[model samples]
Target: MKKKITVKLDIQKIVRITGNHGGYETGECLLCEASGWLEGEFGSPYSTKDTGADLVHKKNCLMNKVLA
Candidate 1:
């Protein structure tokens, strides 16, 4: 069996991330930012994560019912 991996978050990281892409117009999650989502970006594009299977991963997510 394989263990599940998760995205990590921190205060400084969040501040830096949000500061970089806080107003993308999308309600995607910031804390659980996924890497390589953007084309040639390699890093998460504006911290708008599409991986919302977990609770934290769903933070600020557009599909996240909690946000909706």
Candidate 2:
């Protein structure tokens, strides 16, 4: 019998932005002030939906509703 090994990848969570440039009059994320709001709040531009402006990546907020 062969033993299988599983590897765990160590990766940090980095919020990603997917907003269109020149789309909004103001080029800034009101939710997280990350400069990108159109993008889904998750893993470069995290939004307040996850954490408030006071805390981002520093503290985890259960406000991000990925599907909703």
Candidate 3:
């Protein structure tokens, strides 16, 4: 039997890397007031690729814990 490898999503790291790039209305890089946890111009910063969505969040937002 073959085992499947899973990669955990790093919210903090992604936030750090994409800092300020995503368009947030708060005028602050970290603070976002969009419907989702994080707001970006095209899609979620953590997105594997651009999808043209205005806002996006992971199934579970780990970054919120870090921010709070």
Give each model's whole-structure lDDT: 0.33, 0.34, 0.39
Score residue 53 of candidate 1 by CA lDDT: 26
TM-score ranking from best candidate downward:
3, 2, 1
- Clashing residue pairs found in predicted model 3: none
Candidate 3 off by > 4 Å: 17-68
**Best TM-score goes to which candidate?**
3
| Tens-digit lDDT string for candidate 1 (1-68) | 99998654433333222222443322223445532222221233334444532123334432233222
Whole-structure CA lDDT of model 3: 0.39
Kindly give the number of clashing pairs for every candidate. Answer: 0, 7, 0
Candidate 2: residue 12 lDDT (0-100): 23
> Compared with the true structure, what per-residue lDDT tens digits does model 3 show for residues 1-23?
99998656554434432344354
Candidate 2 at residue 64, lDDT?
Answer: 36
Better of 1 and 3 by lDDT: 3
What's the TM for model 3? 0.25
Q: Sorted on lDDT, highest at the top, how do the candidates line up?
A: 3, 2, 1
